[model samples]
Target: MIQNRSLARRGAAVVAAGAAALVLAACGGDGDSDSSAGHGGHKATASASASSSASASASQGQRNAADVAFAQGMIPHHRQAVEMAGLASGRAQSAEVSKLAADIRKAQDPEIKTLSGWLTSWGEDVPAKGAMDHSAHDMGGMMTDGEMTELENASGKAFDTAFMKLMIKHHEGAVEMAKTEQADGAYGPATRMAGEIITSQSAEIEQMNKLLGKD
Candidate 1:
């Protein structure tokens, strides 16, 4: 059974709503900070201003629905890829497959952090870490429980073949989603991330296909 994604999204909305009140309070506090000039107050104030500027620069571009959907959708997609990659350790027959898994983890774990940070900064909900609504979100390349079970239960050549095939499909889905993001997303960082995914994963897909003897 698919979980409801609205719950996660709603949680994000509530946090954003609460942040508004905090923002107002912060504005009032900013006005009062200038009154104090003792105990390195000027230095502290300068540091705070610099931090705020950095945050603002990270959030410079206009975020739209496309950006929101891309982040929300891709988080789960990437998580699933990482989970699949985790299965490739001793179970893989091919040394290349094991290295590929490590590479996927290296690339995606930071991206997960990046996406989570963006969602927090944008007042958007980061998708929770557990079960997700794959059907509702219509994420193109998620594995079903049975498929995960099959991969988990397999070993040697069977594992290698299944991992290659499934991962190719997974990469294809991410590439499609990323392309949409590049075409429609308004936020600069989000769009750039999308472009990076397409370039990187498209190459991976081709490599995996060749490994599977599908070339």
Candidate 2:
């Protein structure tokens, strides 16, 4: 009877050991499942971040019709101003007038290049250099061919006065156009440029008016 009881006790111990091993195996399986879930969540978060980055990039690149119009119109306008400014080298009487012409040329030349680059990036055609003759006739503050020719023939004080008058008018038109761009354009850089144009050219207008004794 003692031997029988010893065998029964040994059997009970074996069953208890089996139960503990099963519990440990179930806990290990749960840990593995949790680890796999955590890894999957990380991958999903990474994918979402990549998608958000792409969306932001696309937003930055987007353009509207008004942006295209602003670039196209401003390029030719800047080019004409540069051309007029180029004629001031030896003809202008006042040092201030000559300096102003130089500034206009310096500022507008690079702006023309930037405008052209924007057009090219947008897959739009840049205005040909010779197109200004036809287009300028209708644009506000643009000088007619006869007026340009008359200024070209003028000298000394006459040239300075004519240059300032024409430039003031030209700057006014640019300011108006820039205002339109600021109001209607969707491109961030282009709108910012428009604001700059308005500020700088308005100041120049005031300067020119004072120079003309009209302020």
TM-scores for every candidate against the unseen true structure: 0.71, 0.85
Per-residue lDDT of 73 in model 2 = 87
Candidate 2 regions with alpha-carbon error over 4 angstroms:
1-33, 133-136
Q: What's the CA error at residue 37 for candidate 1, in Å?
A: 34
lDDT of 2 by residue, 62-134 (tens): 7789889889888878887888898999899899999999999888888889889988998999988868666
lDDT, model 2? 0.89
Backbone Cα, N, C clashes tallied per candidate = 0, 0
- Residue lDDT tens for model 1, 158-201: 99999989889889899999999989988999999999999999
- Report lDDT (Cα) of residue 143, candidate 1: 83
Give lDDT: candidate 1, residue 193: 95
